[model samples]
Target chain A: MIDTIGFDGDDTLWHNESLFSMTQERFRALLAHAADPDDLDRRLLDAERANLKVYGYGIKGFVLSMIESAISVTDGRVPARDLQSLIDFGKAMLEHPVELLPDIADVVEALSHRYRLILITKGDLFDQESKIARSGLAGRFDAVEIVSEKDSASYRRVLERHSVAPDRFVMVGNSVRSDILPVLAIGGHAVHIPYAITWAHEEAEPPDEHYRRIDSVLDLPPLLAAW
Target chain B: MIDTIGFDGDDTLWHNESLFSMTQERFRALLAHAADPDDLDRRLLDAERANLKVYGYGIKGFVLSMIESAISVTDGRVPARDLQSLIDFGKAMLEHPVELLPDIADVVEALSHRYRLILITKGDLFDQESKIARSGLAGRFDAVEIVSEKDSASYRRVLERHSVAPDRFVMVGNSVRSDILPVLAIGGHAVHIPYAITWAHEEAEPPDEHYRRIDSVLDLPPLLAAW
Candidate 1:
């Protein structure tokens, strides 16, 4: 029986990818002289793939890649007149603020009674903490963790910290990687809540057994209530 | 002077609150005997306030609160027959899928060439990553961070990791707390991208000095280009 529940942040609880899409379109228009949107995307993807190790995950790295892609695709011909626009674009992205997924608070409130909840997240600590505080749901968690990465090891640590046995804990989130895969690796049950937009860097192979996929976080309470 | 950019996820990227509104309507129907929709909402909010420490952020917690509220409002007289429907509602939430904010990807690509791009996000790793991957903009970012929270410390780490000075960085998002306040705290610039539905959890005190606010992310490129 599941007694404790762990959740993923980002798309599971709020909106995320659409912002990137907006930025991507703007980038394509700026580079129209050098390449088509498809071509620009391919080049940008290539750059991101090459830089993942150095940049890790987040906007700082992506902005750099956009710069790098512009330089590479344009063969250094992207006019200086447009260079500041690129920088301005990066600045624009940085200034973007956060918004939550629909009905997230309502759902969280509904689920709190039955489960010992833990928020298992990965990212820069300061940013994570600020979001938690702002999220208003911060007060609901028994524990909140900010990790550099989400892997099998991380999942084990979280379970250990909560004294939760794999069979008694269920991981609920949107990613097949950080949420489903890692928990499953530790013999924990997992529920996959697929999101609309997925970051390339966070992509992983499909889930195996011990992992169940869902469309939203609201589904967990009923599943657990029965368990 | 900013050379890099970041974006917040959630309402900024898609349609979210409407789903919760829909679910609330359904839930109110189930508990029509207990209280009116507004009363139910108020009670749920009260319960949410009380349980924030136990459930943390997201739909899992909200659903729990809804269940709790249902039980409370009904004075524990919630019909057993209706219990199944409540559970089904929770399940339905889980099955609900993500739908991207309109024109998001194209805009991001358009802006990518003119700026250094990054996706600065806070939440569960899997959920955030899933949204990024599914959004088809996975290849666009130089970095993708699934942060635990958003605060000054998180922003500092992001800056340090990228070896970029705060003066050269800019933050973009829809939340005043996570995206705007923290960036400003660190002497970095920020732009407030407001969305239609702001999660109560992510809402913060209104605008103050040291920040700029905008109606949408679409206005960013032009605004920044002029900057």
Candidate 2:
């Protein structure tokens, strides 16, 4: 039996990437003069990749990269109001509501009694803590870890914290790279719940059959029961 | 004997408030026309107080509060470039070097084998984790927790995680509000290493006389040795 179940906060349980998408559209318009929408998008991704080490992931880093991209892409011709607008977009994203994906609440409620449920997310500490506080699912989680990145070492640490080995720990998340691959590599069980939108950085070709894949978190309960 | 030692990261182990001091000077110059430096400082503190529940601590929230303070103080007349400058100041603060406070490194190194050390700091997760990673102190800590806030409950949780009660736990830090009082309230031993500069928000009266105080963290090892 699975002793603990780990959930990814953004996109898996709630609408996260969609907010990033909405803000990216605003960004494309803000820099329309600097480059075409497609070109601007590519450049922004490039900036994010380069700044990842310096800023890490989350809204603060994202906002910084947006500013850097805006200034560099426009050759420093971007208006001050436009700079403020980029900051505003990030502020709006941080303040955005945590919209739970269909049946997530129900699944969490149903699963709480049977398994130890924890939130293992990576991002800006403040943003993730704020989101978790506002997510209204706070009291339900047994543990919450806001980490810098999701990797093999992170999974191993999580397993140690939960006091369970790979076979006894299961993960449920939206990203193949973060939620599934690393957990499987550690010999833990994983389930992929497909989100409507995934961050480009989180996308990876699905690993060969060690874990289950379902249409939604809504279907997670029955699938776990069968296992 | 103290079985576990908890160290507050920012101002205690490394230079933190001084960076804020430097940034505040810049903020004052940027908004000099809006209000006097004293007035701006007061308003920013007010903004930080109001947004504490929303943004928490660390550079990101500090920067947001600074922006809000600027807009309100200037009657919305603050220049967009000035606003960008505020964001830039925060970015610079996060990127600031972790300058070790006088004898912190030696104290930690001396006490590592004798105590179960954990770095219990509250702030933006990425920034704190990155600082700890770069500070060359990670090897000394058995555990590192980047919390959203520090309170009686937080201290209690930390003790529980370390599998100890109040008498067996000891904490050392710079802030009366965050580092000292909370630990004392929970019946744990505390040491206050007074930093010359402190954020207005973290200012508070010394609560009773149960804990000890020293001029520098360098004094910590001898103090711990006696206790």
Candidate 3:
């Protein structure tokens, strides 16, 4: 029996990827005057991959990558005003209101009675904390772990701290790379709830295994009940 | 007698503020073409205070503030090449090698046998982790807590988890605001080690208090040995 359920914060519980997409749209528009839109898009993604080694993920990292790519694609002529626009775009993202995914509250509320609900997210500590606190759902979770990254090792360590056996823990989230694969690797159960928009960096190949996938988080309760 | 000791990561144990100062100098240079240095400096400080409300502390927040101030000071004419320079400056700050403060290792070792040593730091998750892993001093601490912020309540919670009473705890660090005041307010002991270059934002009006303030971490051993 699953005694604990972990929820991924960003795209999984709320409309996070939408914010990133909106910002990316603004970034592409700002850099459009200097380079082909498709080329600029590709370069920005490449810069993100390179900067991830140095900057990690989240709005801070995303802003830096946008600035770096703008400079390179424009050969350092991207203009200060445009860079400022990018910075403003990022600030808006940081200040954006937390919007829960459809039926997330009802689903989480139903699951809470059967198993302990925990929030496992990785990002800027303050941003994630602010989002959770503002979500007004902070009191629902039994625990919250804001981490640097989520992998099998991180999941195992978290479960170990809760004195939970791997099989007794289940993770539910949007990203296969972050939410699904890691939990499954640790002998834990998982339900993949696909967000309407998933970050490209989080996409991964399908593993030769079985795990339940749902169109939204609202479907989570009935699946867990069956398990 | 203090039974558990906590060390603040950034300036207390290593050379952290120096990197920030160097980066600020570079930021000043990068924006010099578009605005008066003194005026730009004041504006940047203002931007930092404004952004702190939304970004919190850390190298990432600092970079965003720098970019925002650059845009505002230059009236959005800061130039993309200069913006790229700013991004590189931040990357340098993140990648800079960790340099231990004078006698930090020996001091922590002497105190460890007498009291449980813990590291409490707040900043970008990956950057802090990178510095700690490379510091080669990770094993000296009994535990590490990378938190969102260090406040009275945070200290109280951490102490409770460690099964420690606030009165039995002692925190040592460089900033009076972050390192000294809150811990003292929580009925815990604090030792303020004044770094040569404390960030202006971390400065607070001198409070009436009896907590010890040492010139350096090297001075901590003898002071603690007597206690």
Choose the strongest candidate by DockQ: 3
Best by TM-score: 3
TM-score of each: 0.50, 0.89, 0.92
- lDDT value, residue B137 of candidate 1: 75
**In model 3, which residue pairs have backbone atoms overlapping below 3 Å?**
A80-B79
Query: What are the DockQ scores of the candidates, in order?
Result: 0.03, 0.42, 0.71
lDDT of each: 0.70, 0.82, 0.83
Candidate 2 chain B: 10-residue stretch with minimal lDDT? B198-207
Least accurate 10 contiguous residues by lDDT in model 3 chain B? B201-210
Deviating ranges (above 4 Å) for candidate 3 = A198-210, B198-210
lDDT digits (tens) for residues B1-227 of candidate 2? 68889999988899888898899999999998879999998899898887676566778778877877887787666665677687779878888778988777887998898888999998877788889988999999999987888999988987886688888788888888888898989888898887887554665566555588888776778888888
Compute the lDDT of residue A127 as modeled in candidate 1: 46
Ranking by TM-score: 3, 2, 1
Model 2: per-residue Cα lDDT at residue B112: 93
Tens digits of per-residue lDDT, candidate 3, A3-49, equal: 88999999888888889889988887777688877898899899999
Question: How does model 1 score by TM-score?
Answer: 0.50
**How many angstroms is residue B118 displaced in model 3 relative to the true structure, after the best TM-score fit?**
1.7
